[model samples]
Target: MFRILAIAALLSLPATAYAEKLANKLLGAKEVASQQAPMPIGSYAKGCGAGLVELPETGPSWQAMRLSRNRNWGHPEMINFLVDLSQTAQRLGWAGLYVGDISQPRGGPMTSGHASHQIGLDADIWQLPPKRVNLSRAEREKLSSIPVRSADQKSVTRNWTRTHHELMKAAALDPRVDRIFVAAAVKIEMCKTAKSSDKKWLQKIRPIQGHDSHFHVRLKCPAGARLCQTQKPSVNELSKGGDGCDDTLMWWVTDYLNPPKPTKKPKEPAKRTRHPREYTMADLPKQCLDVLASP
Candidate 1:
C-alpha cells in the first residue's frame, strides 16, 4: 500500500517538474573538496568547477558580499587575479572593491539569479567602491549598490565618478579579462571620454541590460583544463576594433532601453505550455558529475 502511494504521488507531478527535481538532487551539493585540483569544465553559462577556492570574506582592499549564499568560491587563478586587482584599485585612489558573486563551490547552475557565473571565471563588481573593508556580515547584506544610470536610462547619473571610470578601465586592460559587461549608458560614457589611444580598451567593454548597479567581468579560458568550452564569437567581434557604439548601441538604446508598447489584441485565455529548458546534470559535461560527487 505504501509503495503504491509513493508511485501515485510521483505520477501526479508534471514531467518537466519531475525532471527538474532529479536535476536539483544532483546539483544541490555546494561544498568544495580540499584534496582535488581546481578544474573548470564546460562553458561559462553551463559548467562546473572542481577543487574550488573561496575568496576571503574580507581583505585589506576588498570585501565579499552576500556571505550566506556561500557563492564566493572560484578557481585559484581567478581568486589571485581579484586580489591583485583590488590592491591595484586601492593604489589608484579608489576606496576599495566591493566584490559580488563569483561562483558556487561546485560551480553549476544556480537555483536562481544568474544564467552565467557557472564556470568559476565570471564575477560581479559593484559600482559603489567600498569605503571600508571592515563591514560586518549583516552590513554587507544590507548595503545597496549605487545605480549609475540616469532616471531615463539614457545617461549616467550624478553619482557616477571619474574613479568609477578608472576602476573599470583598469579591469578591462587586464590581460585575463575577456570582456566586461556594463549598461549601455556606461559604455557610451566611456566612448565619449576615452582618449584616442584608449579607444582600444573600449572594445573590451560590452553593453548589456540591468548592469547599471554592477559590471560583470568574464575571464578568458585559463592556460589548461582542456575539457572547458568557449563561447562563440559575438556577431560584432570587439577585438576587431569594434567599439560597439554603432547600430548595435542604437538598437539597445532605442529598442531594448525604451521598447514600444505591445500591440493589444482580443483577450484570450492563457494556455499551459512546457517550461523553458533548464540545465541539469546531463546538460553539463560528463566530468561535472564527478566534480559534484567529490569530497
Candidate 2:
C-alpha cells in the first residue's frame, strides 16, 4: 500500500511543480538547451524546442544582433539556413547579413517582443544589409535596422533597393523556407519590381505588420520532426498559387490598423485571443514539461 501511494505522488510531481508557474518565466530562465536529440516539439507559435544549437555570435558572413537576449539558439536546420543565407547576401552586393532574434536556448514562450517564435524554426533577419559583419557586442545593440517601408506604410522607402529585392527572392526560393514575412508595403514593392517570369518564388513572401525593419523567416517543420505541427494552408495559398500582391494592401492594412466592428454582439462572449505570456505548462504541449525538466 505504501509503495502504491509513493508511485501516485511521483506521478503527480510534475503537475504540482509546473501547472501554476508561467511557462514564459520557466522557459525564459533557461540559459542552455535541453540535453536531447534535436527536435522542434510543437507549432510555431505554441511550442518549444529541445536540443537547440546556438548560432555563433559572430560568423564570417553574419553577426547576430542583440546578444544580451541570448536568443541566438535554434534547431540545427535553422543555424545552417542562416549561414547559407548570409553567404547568399554577399553575392547580392552586401558584406553579409545582420541576423536578429532566432530563439531562446530552450525555445518556448518568450517573456516579451513576440507572440510567435516559440518554436526554433522562426527567425528575424534585419533588412539592413550589413556594411560589416564584425560589430562589437555594444555596437550591435546600439545599431538599428533601417526601415524599408514608409511611415504611412503605403510604400517602400529609398532604402528599399535591388539588393533587398534579390535577397528576399533568394530566401523565398529556398526549399527549407515555408514563408517569409515583411511589411505590407515591402510586399507591394516586391510585387511591382519583380520580373513577370520571376513571380513563382514571390508566393512565399507573406505580409504582416511591424516587419518594416526586419523580415521574419519561418521554416517548415524539419523533415521527420513528427511532433512539430505544420501550419494549415490559407485559402489563398491553396487556390491562387500567385504572388500575394493583389489585395495585400486592403486585406492587411485596413483590417489590421482599423478592424471592422462586429455587426452585433452574440449571446456568448467572444473567445479572447490567447497570448503566450499568460501560458503555463498546462497550456503547452505535454512534452514541453519534459523539455523543461531535462538537464
Candidate 3:
C-alpha cells in the first residue's frame, strides 16, 4: 500500500537525499508559488503543491484576514472555490467572508499550525460572517471569529444562525468539496433540524473537534493530479450513501466530550507519533524534491 511504502521510505532514504533540512523550513521559506504546471504532489497531510496561486488579499465579496501570516495562497481551484463561496456568503445575508489561512505560497508542512493544509486543498473559513468586507489591514488583524458552539460543547450558541446552516449546506452541495469540518455540537444541531428526506448533503459536513470558530473545507483532488491521494471518509455509513446523522455522529457528544475512565492501563506505552512539522524532504513523496527545487 502507498502508506506502507511511504513509511518504508522514511527509514531508508538515499544517501544523496538523507539529512536534507526540514521540509517545513525549506518549503515554508518560499514566498511565492513554483513555475511548474499545477499539480498536487501527495496526500493532504504529506504533500507539496505545484503552481499554487494567491487568493487576492481583498475581493468584492471576501477579505483574506491576518495578512501578516501571508497564508492567502492556494491551488487555483481552491482560490476560485473560496471566491465563489464568498459570494454565496454574501447572498446568505452576511456582508461577505473574512477568509482565513489557505496555504503557504508553495504548499508543504507549515512551521506552525495545521498539519493538513500542506496540500493547498484544505482551508479554514471563519465562523464570524463579515460585518463588512472592506476592513483595513489593522481592523482585520483585531477581528476574531465568533464561537458558534456552546461553552458546554453540547449545543450551538446564539451566534449560530440560520445563515450559517445554509452557508454550510451550500458548500456541502458543491461537487468539488470533499468534506467540511465543523465542531461536533454544531453538526449535532444541524442534524437535529435536517429533514430525513433531504439530508444527503449533510454527509460531507464532518464533525471534528475545536472548530467552534471556523469550518475547514477540504477539496477533492483535481482531475489529472496523478500523484494525489484519495482519502476515504471516516464513517462507514457515509460510504454507503447514508446521511451521517446516526449513532456514530452522536458519539462525539456523548463519549468524546465525556470519555469514560480507563478501566485498565496498557502495559506498553503507546508509540509517539511524529508531527508533520518534523517531516524532512526524504519523508515526503519522492517528487517533492523536484517541487522544492523548481523555480
Candidate 4:
C-alpha cells in the first residue's frame, strides 16, 4: 500500500507541474504569429489567416468593408478589441475613439515602411477633450477658469500626440494585439510613464521613429484569418536624438516600424564562399617545409 501510494503521488506530480507551466505560459504570452501567408490586397473572403484563434462564420464580423462600424464580418474577438478599446478610452477620457486602417490597400511605397496594415486588425485613435479630466469641474475651475475643450479642438485630431497614450495603453493590454507603432515622441513618454506591469506588457509593442503623424497598431492574425501572414517583431536598435524623450529605455520594432537608414554603405559579404583547405607542416611542399624548419 505504501509503495502504491508513492507511485500515485509521482504520477500526479507531472500533471500538476504541467498545469502550472501552461498557466504561466499563457500569462506570459507577449505575442503570436500567423502560420500562413496573408490574404492578397482585395480578397473579400473571411478567415484569411491561420494559426490564430478561429471565429464564427456568421454575419457582422470585424473588418467589414474597410470600416469597423459595418455590421457584417465583425468577429466577436475583433469586436471585443474595439469594445475594450472604447471602454478604456472613455475611462481615460478620449474622443473619436475607434479603429482605423484595416489593411494597406495601396501596395506601393508607403510611409509606414511595411505591409502591417494589410492583416486587418490595426487601428488609430485621436485624443480626448481636456474637460474630461479626472478632477472635479468645480475644483478645476477654481484653479483655472479656462476651457480646455477649445484647446483640444484646436489640436490635430488625426495625428499622434501625448493624449493618444490612453489608446496605446489599451492596445498594449489586449492579448490579441501583436504590436503597436507610435510616434517616437509618444513612445518616449510611454517609456517614462510605463509601470512594472505595463513595462512587461509593452515589450510586445515595437516602437520606431517617424510616427508623429499617426500611430500604427497591428494585431496578431486570428485563426479565422486563414491566409493572414505571420508578423515578426523587429530587433532592438539604438535611437538617435530628437525631442529628448528619455533615451534610456530599450526599444523593439513593431510590425509598422522600419530599419534605420545606414549612415554609410555596409560592408558586402565576400563573394568567394569557399576557401583553400588549411595546411599543416606535414602536408607542406618540400621547399616550404625546409624553409619553415630552418627558422
Best by TM-score: 3
Order the candidates by lDDT, highest first: 2, 3, 1, 4
Instruction: Estimate, for each residue in 146-229, the C-alpha lDDT of model 4 and write its tens digit.
Output: 211222222223344454655676677777876776544455556667664436555544445545444556566666554344
lDDT for each residue of candidate 3 in 1-295, tens digit (9 for 90 to 100): 5444654655477765667678999899988888778888899999899888899998999999998888888888899999999999988898889889999888899989988998789899999978888899999889899999998888899999989999999999999999999998888888998877889888888888879999999999998889889887676444777767785465786678888778897579778999999998878898776667666
Per-residue lDDT of candidate 1, residues 1-295 (tens digit): 5534544564466877755653334554555543468888888877788887899999988999998877898888889889988998898887678899998888878766787887789999999877788999999889989999887778999878888888888888899888999988899888788786657777779888879999999888888878778767776673577766665467867788788776997578789642212665657776776665555
Candidates 1 and 2 compared by lDDT, better number: 2
State the C-alpha lDDT per candidate: 0.79, 0.88, 0.86, 0.38
Clashing residue pairs in candidate 3 are none
Roughly what TM-score does model 2 have, to 2 decimal places?
A: 0.90
| Candidate 2 local lDDT, residue 221 | 93
lDDT of 2: 0.88
Off by over 4 Å in 1: 1-25, 258-277
Q: After TM-score superposition, what is the CA distance of residue 1 in candidate 2 from its true location, in Å?
A: 24
Which candidate comes out best when scored by lDDT? Answer: 2
Error of 2 at 179 (Å): 0.4
Candidate 4 structure lDDT: 0.38
- 211 Cα displacement, candidate 3 (Å): 0.6
Candidate 4 ranges with C-alpha deviation above 4 Å: 1-79, 96-98, 104-115, 127-163, 196-198, 224-226, 236-295
| True lDDT of residue 262, candidate 4 | 72
| Poorest stretch of ten by lDDT in candidate 1 | 273-282
